[model samples]
Structures are given as C-alpha cells and as structure tokens.
Target chain A: MGVSVLQPGLATTVQDVGRPGYYNVGIPPSGSLDQYSSLAANLLVGNAEDAAVLECTYMGPELRFGSPATVAVTGADLPPLLGGEPRPAWESFAVGAGEVLSFDYLRSGARAYVAVSGGFDVPAVLGSRSTYALGSLGGLEGRALVAGDELPIGDAGGAAPGRSVPEALRSTHPRHREIRVMMGLYDHRLTDGGRRTFAEATWRLTTLADRTGMRYRGATLEFRERVAPFGAGSDPSNIVDAPYPIGSIQVPGGVEPIVLHRDAVSGGGYVMVATVISADMDDVAQSAPNNTTRFVEVDLRPGRRARRRRAARLEALREALA
Target chain B: MSGAGGPGAERAPTVAIRSPLPGVFYRRPSPDFDPFVEVGSPVEPDTTGALFELMKQFFEVPAGTTGTIAAVAVADAEMVDAGQVLFTVRGS
Candidate 1:
C-alpha cells in the first residue's frame, strides 16, 4: 500500500547509489544524477543495483499504484504513463492497483529514472537512501516528492517486466554536450589564457541547474593574478578550502563555471577549474537548462578509459536486465 | 462539452497547463496575492495553478486538470521553460 504522491514533478527526489563516506564532514553525495539512468531503472525494476529510485527532474511525478508495481522508465525522454496509457521508456512496465504513474513533456534527457518493484523503501541516510535535499540527508524525509507522499514499496524483487536495456546500453541526452574534463586541481589558478578560457569555452547550461551545482554561462574565465594565500579569499578565484571532486570545475568571478553536481558542498573556497570525468557524470546529469556544454580536455588515461567504459556499460546493463 | 458527434456541439477539452519546472512563472499566490486561477477561474484538481520560481524555491504550479481557466499562458513574471505552456485549461 505505498507509492502515493500525485503530482510532485519538477525536482521529485529520492535517488540512490550515493552518500559515499560522508565527504570528510560537510556531506554532499546526494546521488543518482543519471547514474547510468539510475542503473537502468534498477535493472528494469527487479531492483538491487542500489535500489531507492524516483529522481525525475525536468518534470515527471504523479505516481499512485498502491499495490501492483514493477515499473521502470529510465533517464529522461520523459514519457512514462500507465493508467493513462502510453508506457514504454527504457522498458519494464506494470503498475495496476489504482495504476497511474504519469509524466510526458521533456523529450530528450535531463533526469527521469523512476524504477519501482521493491525499492523506494527509504531509510538509509548516511549509508544512502540518497536524496540529500541540500543536506536534510537521504530520501523522503529529506524532502522533494511532495503531494501526499506515501512511497514505501520494498518487498517484491522478482518483477522484471519485459526487461530491455540494450540499444548499446542506452544513454543519449545530447543537444550538444561534450563534457570530459580532467585538467588540474585549481588548474594552477588559471592562465595560459586562463587554461585557454577553461578548455576553450562553450558552456551555457544555466538556469543555475540543481542537485547542487551546474551554473556555466559561456566562459569569461581568466584568473591568475595571484597574491592572496593566507586563508585565501581575495578571489583569484579563492581556493585553500579544497575537497569537491564529484565533477568539480568551479570558477567564481572568473565568470560562471560551477559544475559540482550530486549535491556537492563537501568542500569549497572555489578555484577548481576541472574534473568532470566519471564517465561523463552521466553527461553532467543529462545536461539540460538550455544545454550547450563542451568542457573536453581529458587525460588520466582517457579518464581511466572513461571509467572502464562506464563499468562495461553497467556490466552490460546487468546482463541485459538478466 | 463532449462534442465531435452532437450535443451542444461540445468543446471544453483545452488542457495545456505546462511549466512543471524551469523558473519565474508565478501568477500570484503572493505579491499581495489574488492571481492563482483567474482567466475565468474554476480550476480544482489539486489547485494552485502557478508559481514555479527556482533558486529561490517556490514550486506549486499544480492545477492538474479538472479545469476552466482557458488561457493565462504565462506573463506575470514570465520566464517559464521545462515544457512552457502555463495555462489554457477548459478541461473539466
């Protein structure tokens, strides 16, 4: 008797596959900004690739199903629907009891995930039920999916509805996105025409973005005037605070840049300049806000072979949804 | 309203609504309130009908159908995005 919420789109939360170690003290590891389409919607709802699910941004919530479940709708292309008909999106679909599910509108990526079967039980916190709604920490109670709430699910795990995750392990989102990055920590505080205007500008993604960082706006980058040090603040893009990493990038007055993602806060003081490469943090979480990225500039052995080709495309989408 | 084959020649279904996210939008709920469902009123299905905002949070926008307002399509504070539309209900 769970999955309730009736309209909580635009930022619906819950997510999973995050909350790693606690970032020294500040916390920031929210989770599932497209973790390969939230692990192919938990392997097409049979669950267990980190469970928890939901995520939906660029709109899609409305849920209902207080009984029969087995859902799936992976990242973006935002289509979903069930009691209202039109289903299929990264496959797997069933719902029933009071059915509903909903969503439509956002064509092409920006965040969608969903999953359902047994996951969404919501509890983990530091170990990760992953919502981190700005540190309120872990799913549900931490916030986001509003309208009536309910959620609960967690029992079934054998509902693989049709499965399907192939199309080359699916993951496209592109209205121009490039992404990649690697450069250096604080990128030597910039120069060399500010890291060539931070790896030759193009940026854009800005409506500020969400899970904590994204900002961008076509490059003004330049930094490198130096002379601040002791506690470093005088903005040559500051620095001295450290940590960040999830996809880092920072830039501050050098003009816009931001990129941090997955609820990042872990550490700051600005000055990052480059990092983005955990196999393109799911292409910077499906990019969006006006999309138009481009950071490029890799190395670190092609960012560890693009994170072992995104872990062999999530182990071939868990053996093609097993 | 069920037309396409008789009765008063029907009509109603209009729907639209949109703007589930990207900021600004707002048709009131503040700034000395009042604007929530105007252009002909009625609304219902969970109510609220407009308020997106962003970065400064806000959210609401609901009006999930059961409608009447047939036209508001954004303006007060504008901005919109994430599907756009903003209103045109008629539905019921």
Candidate 2:
C-alpha cells in the first residue's frame, strides 16, 4: 500500500521506540517522545510495539491512502478526519483505497501518533526509524515529512477487527500541566532559597520548548560560584561535559531549567538537578507553550515501580485489543 | 592564614573538570571547522576548548584552568563519558 502526504504539519516524522546503545557516540536515542502513546497506536493496528508510526507535532499532516488499510491514532488527540468525517482516536479504524486523512488543530497534547498495520515502510538508521533532525538521519530522508512525499506502507496481511483502549488506561492520559522531577544532580549546589523557589514557583513554557529540550522562563535558580557537585549514574553535573538522557533536567548559571527530550544531546556543562520519571515523561512531552509547570521530586525506587505498573497496564490493554 | 578554613590550613589547589551532561563529543564545531584548542595553547578559565552537541543544542566546555593546554585525551568526534578526561592543562 502507499500513502501520499498532501500537507505535512508543523513537523511530522516517522518514529519508533528509539535508537539505543549509541549514547557514548553522542547520538541520542531519537524516537517518540511519548513512547506510551506510540506503542498504543501501533498495538491498535496489531503492529509490534516498536513499529514505525507517523509522529505529528502540534499541527498534523494531510494524506491519502492508496489501498485499504487498518490504522490507529494515539497520543495527544489531534481531531483527525477520514474523508471529511471525524475520526476518533485511541482505537483502531479502517480506511479504504483512495481515502483522504486529515487532521485539525490540536485539541489536547503537543503531538499525536498515527500507526498503520505493517508500519510505515521507511529505512531504519542506526537501528531506528525515528528522525533525529540535527544529525539529519532516519525517518523520511532523515527529516520531517514534506508535501508531495509518497510513503510506502507494508502489508501485514489482512486487518484484524477494531479494538478500544481500556477505560482505566484512557483515564491516565495527562491533562494537567504539572511535571514531576527527581531533585537534580545539582540540587545541593543551589542555596536553600533557590531550591525552595524552584519547587514553589510556577514557570510558563517558553517558545524555546521543542523536541530536543524544553526551556522554562520564570524564577532563575542560583548556585554558589564554586564548581557544582556531580552525581552518579546519569545524574547532572557542573562539569562542562557529561552524558545526557531523556528527561535530564539541566540548570546553567543556577537558573532556568531545561528538560531534555528524545532528540536531546549526549552531554554538556549544565548541572542536571533532576530527571523526570519515565511514567510522567508523556505528560511533559504533550505540554504546549505557555502552559505552567511545577516540579516535584520522587524517590527512584517508587518511581521505577510506578513505571513498571504503567507499562504492565498498557501491555494488558494492548493484549485485550488483540 | 591560620584561621579556621584559612590559607595555612587550606588543601592543595587541584583543578578538576567534569562533564556538564551526557552527549557525543565533537572536537571541532562542525565537520569542516578546525578544533577550538590544542596542546600548549594558552587558555583562560572561561575559554571554550570544545563543544558537546546534544539533540541540537550546543554546550561549550570552558577552560577551567588558566594555563597552557597540556594533553588532548579524547579524539575528534568521539563519544565521551561523563567525568572522562578531555584534556589536561599545566597552570602557568
């Protein structure tokens, strides 16, 4: 089957789970910022959890299918339409040959995932189909989908019947703007007042937010002039160089928190004070500009358990649909 | 000098450089650009010797020591570990 792009959204690219085991080479595991949503979309169409899907940021793309296929839309609800009629999200649906698929303005969430059976037929780069725009690799020509681009869709045989996401899983989709963070690698470097201000103050998302990192504009966190302390195993540091992970929060000059995301760099000089827990990263990804965010710290043991529980529930939901 | 935390009681001065965050290390700014600094180059405390570009943002590594560059440990366009040595400088 084939799919043609009529209008590519603000930035739409194919993404999977991400490329791993290359962080030391400075290549981030660029993939879906919201893995939960991406997996859900794929599972809706009976595709593997890591299948490539169309990731639409803010605005979405317009496309036409060449052959009948089963597809699903997950992540932030973008209010998609199939052939001029409204299409519901978080469930599987069928599209016939020569049908047009369009999306309107985002109703909620910063991005949405579109998964088709057999997945998007895109070349994988470094073991992933996710696009890393800076390196200019992966996805459609290693960049965002453009108008007039034709994408081949693999045929995963015939379509399975449609399925719905469980009510419990659906309820967990984050609508609030609050983002939970573990106190960062440099949490101690900041004065008591600085730490309190960070926890208490409400910061608005600046236009600086993007796939690489989210920059907040609000109270500036200050630190003692001496070199800030470094933390162990993926924690932040004052040393001008270090490896970075998705959800790593870096504070430079003791002010303004930058939350790294899917496309974030491998290392740098800022003090990473906290890391957003995995379970809540989707909430951070779907945050729109101007949304207010507050950071809260949680211990790692409990945080890991929460992530496992969420993952198990999502898997159970996918199995139910199957 | 003899007071609490005074000069006479102070520990020896040792320069320590650490990784700012985790990312890939590029010695030069881009593929075509020359490296920012080299061995024996005079560096101030704030001079950026190299850069680590994560995602798309570029974070510069400041010369933490005011001296002549002594050794270049990491190769150009290499992956560096957090707290790994990139260079050494001998204080003037």
> What lDDT would each prediction earn against the true structure?
0.79, 0.76
Candidate 2 per-residue C-alpha lDDT over A1-322 given as tens digits, one digit per residue, 9 for 90 to 100? 6899999876789899999888788888889988888888888888877789998876679999988888888887687799989988888899989999998666666779999888997988888888988899898898899999999887654347477777667533333467777886757767778788888888766556678998876787766456334543232336646677789888765556889998898887777778898888878888755556888878988788878988897778777777
Tens digits of lDDT, candidate 1, A134-177: 66767889978888889887895746478877787787777787
TM-score of each: 0.35, 0.73
Tens-place lDDT digits, model 2, residues B3-81: 3223432242335455433345777888888888887577788988889754345679998877666678878866554
Best by TM-score: 2
The regions of model 2 sitting more than 4 angstroms off are A171-175, A227-238, B1-92
Q: Cα lDDT of model 2 overall?
A: 0.76
In angstroms, give how far residue B49 of model 1 lies from its true place.
Answer: 3.7
Using lDDT, give the best candidate's number: 1
